[model samples]
Target chain A: MEQILRYRVQNDFSALSRFLEELRGLPGYARLNERQAYRLGLVLEEMISNIIKYGYDDSKVHEIEVVIRWGDMKITVELSDDGHPFDPMRHHCPGSNSAEPLEQRPIGGLGIHLARQMSEEMTYRRENGRNILQIQIGGGVAGD
Target chain B: MEIGFEMKDKMTIVHLQGRLDAETSPAAESQLLPRLSASGGNWLVDLKDLEFISSAGLRVFLMLAKRARECGTKLTLCSLRPGVRNVFEISGFCTIFAIEDSPAGI
Candidate 1:
């Protein structure tokens, strides 16, 4: 069986926290093991935080739509925002070269990088002035 | 999130409890950054009770690590849960910060 959940989240930290708590309360969430739940939360937090921080240029409030499709072995999240046309897949991840000294490493893209690493698959697209990102988690294979 | 401090030897053990995500990261940064100084000795962040961490939380750790380096001090993390450890490793933070299984020795 599959379950679908949808939420309209405000572009703010408080809303994000509330949404995350609600997500944890879902019946499907109970099926996820500790590691899977943690990865899901991390991916959601990283992606939504980026949208709240950089997806907008104006100070106006916006609503981000999130859809979660919870399956028996996998969970998929679809996030749509009307803020900007940014693609997370193409975002440059700095500070990844471990060979570089710590002091010289820049800390700009670690968030997106972490999100990408935790999720099984991530795809981004722009449609009708909205940036839509879909991320899949579970299936037992994540950044081992 | 709640942060408590304990002094062991010359090291400062920071106990972090609760979730450290975007909602709490700003406060965590403000509260933790001012405590680091050149004269201060090493720091070991204890995340045993920390239920969750996101990129925002990671950013604060990165900043703290950078500041600790600038102040000529060492920063280590210990007692990371499996979930938390995965985040650190995936972000390559494991290479930057010294990690321990427990807070046994500084």
Candidate 2:
């Protein structure tokens, strides 16, 4: 069996927060520790925010599909967006390992790099004109 | 996430409650940056109620600290939760920044 939650909302930030809260209550997410859960929420928010701001080019409404599955020892979260197909993993992350001053440095594309650093395994692919990204989280008790 | 401010003479105290993820970090950054300009050499960040934080959230802290340093003000974090503390340790921020178990100690 699989758990799925789909959302269609305006390019608003509140919708992302509500979607993350829903994931926190899922059975599959119950196994993750606070750190993993928080990281997962951050990754999801960053991806969604990028799509909302840059993917749709200010489109009024965007649809996102989130599918979660509980494996024997791992939890998989897949997020698919119908906005533009952009792979964040390949984006150039500014201020990466730099000693530049904060005001001088631009806040460019660091979210994706941060997400990759926190997740145990992360993959991104474009399928059916949608960006499909999956993350595997473990290192906790088994799901009840 | 809820952010409350307390003015301690010239020092500013920011209390962060709830989870500070990518979504909430921007709010923190926006609220904290402008306050740093008037800080009289000290800013205390109270994270006692913060249950969890990710890299995205941590970035906000780093940015604040960097800005404070440039302005000759100090940014100190107090009362970090265990999970949030672990993120600091992993990021090697524990040594670079001043962190205490409680605000009273800071």
Candidate 3:
């Protein structure tokens, strides 16, 4: 059987924290190995934090929808935000010039890069004025 | 996240416990940034008990490293869990910061 978890969070850090807490209480979360779970959490945090910090233009409150499907040795997370249209897949990844000095290195792109690196697959698209990002990670279920 | 520190001779060891994400990163930065001395010194961050970290946390560490460089202070990170290690490696932080298995040698 598959376990699907859905969550709605505001465009704020505290909401993200609460959503993560709720996620950890689910049975599907217990099936994940330490590494898989960590990657999932990291990806969610990176994506949500990015949307909260940069996805919005006005001071109005917005809601982000998160859906997670777990089973079949895989876990997929989908995040939908009604903020501006931004594609994480097209975002730049920094640290390409590893030899560059620290002062010259830019810090803006590392979050998206790390999120992309942690997941097996990531896709982004704009639909109905909403930005939808889907991330999938394989081999999520742990063995006894 | 709980931040604690211990001074040992010329080296100061800082212990980080709990999650370091967007929610806690601002407080972590406020506490950690002020601890970096303008004078030269050695510092080690122990992450054995740190359960989680995201890009927000990584940004704080990067800022700390930059400040340490400007102050002529030595900064090191030690005892990272496997998950945290993966994050550092992916972000190329493993090359930028001095990381070790433990605080025994350095």
DockQ of each: 0.67, 0.37, 0.65
The TM-score-based order of candidates, best leading, equals 3, 1, 2
| Model 2 Cα lDDT, one tens digit per residue, A1-144 | 445445554467787777777778877677656555666665667667777778786646777777666544555778788888888778876645445545565544556665666667888999889888888766455422
Q: Could you tell me the lDDT of residue A40 within candidate 3?
A: 87
Screening candidate 3 with a backbone cut-off below 3 angstroms (N, C-alpha, C), the clashing residue pairs are: none
Instruction: Give TM-scores for every candidate, taking all chains together and pairing residue i with residue i.
Output: 0.91, 0.77, 0.93
Give me the overall lDDT of model 1. Answer: 0.86
Instruction: Residues B50-71, candidate 2: write the lDDT tens digits.
Output: 9777656777877787778888
Q: What are the per-residue Cα lDDT tens digits for candidate 1 across B11-99?
A: 88899998988889899999899897633898999999998988778889888988998888889899999888888887778888999
- Cα displacement (angstroms), candidate 1, residue B66, comes to 1.8
lDDT: worst 10-residue window of model 1 chain B: B33-42
- What fraction of the native alpha-carbon contacts across the interface, defined at 8 angstroms, is recovered by model 1? 0.71
Best by DockQ: 1
Q: Can you write out model 3's per-residue Cα lDDT over B1-106, one digit (the tens) per residue?
A: 9999898887788999998888899999999987886335689999999989888898899889988998888999999998889888888788899999998858
Q: What is the TM-score of chain B alone in each candidate?
A: 0.95, 0.92, 0.96
RMSD of 1: 2.2
Answer with 1 or 3, whichever has the higher DockQ: 1
